[model samples]
Target: MSRKTLNLDSTLYDYLISQSLRETPIQSRLREETAALGGPAGMQVSPEQGQFLAFLASLIGAKRVVEVGTFTGYSALSVALALPADGRITCCDVSADWTAIAQRYWEQAGVAGKIELRLAPALETLDALVSEEGVDKVDMAFIDADKERYDGYYEACLTLVRPGGLIAIDNVLWGGAVADPANKSADTEAIRALNAKLKEDRRVDLSLLPIGDGLTLCRKR
Candidate 1:
């Protein structure tokens, strides 16, 4: 009798996947390899979340996207697959190691030409985009980098993304830690602050969706 979002238990979640997920072989291989990495593999976006991002990108007709974190490139690949042939995404990540794995999978998926990997601090890369390309031209931007710098990334993306463009932020709920005042970890605090700020922010249309670890999708207005 609940009217709100369903609280998905394992059985329900399995049923949901059984009904809706349409992961390709390339995506499955990427997920399996990422899972083999043990605990760190948890950073990879859930397969359904990847599908949702592709849908969102397609909805907005995204041709130029900026990704703040690439990690093994699952999210980037998912969106890249949805984009047209000439579409491009600038992927920012500090790790050459992880991005090498990403590069391999991206090439395997035939989306390598659509993605440009920048092995530098994401803030630096974002700032360069604003400086070199000017503002209000990016179709979309996804922020999933260092939590403390989320506000910085958001502001940079705010400047870079065109009006009505989308900025999708990952882990806004921080695994339910944002609502609990006791968890004062730096990352938790950062996400909490950003969530509150987004609520009051007049510049965008915001929705905090219960997808994956919690995705905050903001459309610049």
Candidate 2:
């Protein structure tokens, strides 16, 4: 057996999905609709990533969740499905156009009642959460918004999530640009800086996994 993570080519990746993924019909249709939007569709998490988020929430017995990005609502839907009937998730997003698409799919999925869509600047939404909910009130949080503001999201999530709760940050690798010193774009550098900080941050225990453009999981201590 290999000691390190295996590089998955497309064929192997498809095989892996065939063997392990359990996407529902609504999820698949949502994916297809998002894909039809062309380049912007890439912002949606892959099916496996959505499943993993669900698994994490279920594993933690999470009932209260927060999402910093709700693009078309795939991830939110996934997690909502795993929560108990009384559970809820507050989704932060500014795009009415995009989240409207998300709202339709969420309604169809029958998880609409479980999700609250906040259409405003994400930071404003997050800060308001801290004020309204107080610290340590959230069970889990997912961050997948603007790369430049990831640190802000992470900090807010750190405060919101209870001790031992998790904060899952998406696109931590920024398409592998964080490792390339020459690729010093603003988004890339912001992600790179967060990666470095997370590695040493004493407030949480971290793991940077090589899943879905790199997902960083921080369990608040």
Candidate 3:
């Protein structure tokens, strides 16, 4: 009872990628570096996802973008590289270890100046930002942090994003487990509940794409 498109083998996935345009050299190198790092090679966003995010950022003309997770900087760099010359992105992550790698790649991408890396619990940072007046000014927000706190992040983002802005939450499908009633794992349950909540929430217009672990996009109304 899960999403079928989510189940593609390595060979088929590679074939699908081969059919599409390839990433630039710098992006390819970044992928290689992420692969070498190992433990969470999958943490890096897919090339298609990166390109899509970049286009989305540019389309919104986002000046003050916020990313809840900055694993090895791939997503941050993707957004930063697309931002306007005067644009800036705030990246939140708690691990110095993972972000250290992201820092190097951001420098290599020449986008380090456009990104501000904050090392702290994402929820705390989000709450603090919301607490500051004149700071409820985010044009876009990307949430990909702790599964258990997904709703909390969504609420915080609802307050943080501009009326017409977007909140892109990653892993909403949780590898299709959200649709599988039999899979009762904690992460799966969290995503399932969050999906149901968003589906009924009239505050935003929602679209759940079967892309990279399933990306749920919500635009503020």
Candidate 4:
């Protein structure tokens, strides 16, 4: 195992969040609940990212949203809260252990009825959604699961989201690995490859933001 940590420089990270995030009571409660779970605190989405996600969902008038990584439901909750009264989110993850925490928080946030949690491989779930008639009607999607499958998720999301919709991909920078040529782990290479692929993909308009790791926003053209 490598001893190195992939974290933002403290000052810069704090500055970024401070400038972009506006914390609410729900976010505080979610953080406390995540801490209680103990093992997957990092799974929680950043406050700034959560607010940004809400903004994105509203911008697209997203009635149907999809998330590739539920991870205790923080991000799902963020998006769900922003959704219209009848809006819904399909959350996919392979972890029953972590999703249990997600379920609890969803109930606490009163967004449980808005979320459908699926315990299965994210790619499989995504592909199945694409094949299922009437289910490919997603307005927005967020991909934040295993880095190695980032490309697969991107392709699946591209098909799932409607034309002109948004797909927000998390962790594309891999904590700066995509910028360093020396680092060549499977995850790093996968992100680099996906980045290149997105640059050339004609189906979408893409802009990479250096936010919380890095987020690539793709709007289906």
Index of the highest-lDDT prediction? 2
Candidate 1 local lDDT, 1-221, one digit each (tens): 77899989999999988899888899999999999999989889999999999999999999999999989999999999999999999999999888898999899899999999999999999999999899998999999888999999999999999999999999999999998989999999999999999999999999999999999999999
Measured on C-alpha atoms, candidate 4 has an lDDT of: 0.86
- Predicted structure 1, TM vs. truth: 0.98
Steric clash pairs (candidate 4): none
* Overall lDDT per candidate, in order of appearance: 0.94, 0.96, 0.86, 0.86
TM-score of each: 0.98, 0.99, 0.91, 0.89
User: How well is each residue in 77-188 modelled by candidate 2, as lDDT tens digits?
Assistant: 9999999999999999999999999999899989999999999999999999999999999999999999999999999999999999999999998888999999989999
RMSD of model 4 against the true structure: 5.2
* Number of residue pairs clashing in candidate 2, backbone atoms closer than 3 angstroms, sequence gap of 3 or more or interchain: 0
TM-score sort, best first: 2, 1, 3, 4
Candidate 4 on 121-174: residue-level lDDT in tens?
998899878887354488999999999998889888888888888999999888
Worst 10 residues of 3 by lDDT: 1-10
Off by over 4 Å in 2: none
Model 2 error, position 116 (Å): 0.2
Q: Ranking under lDDT, best-scoring first?
A: 2, 1, 4, 3
Candidate 3: which pairs clash? Answer: none
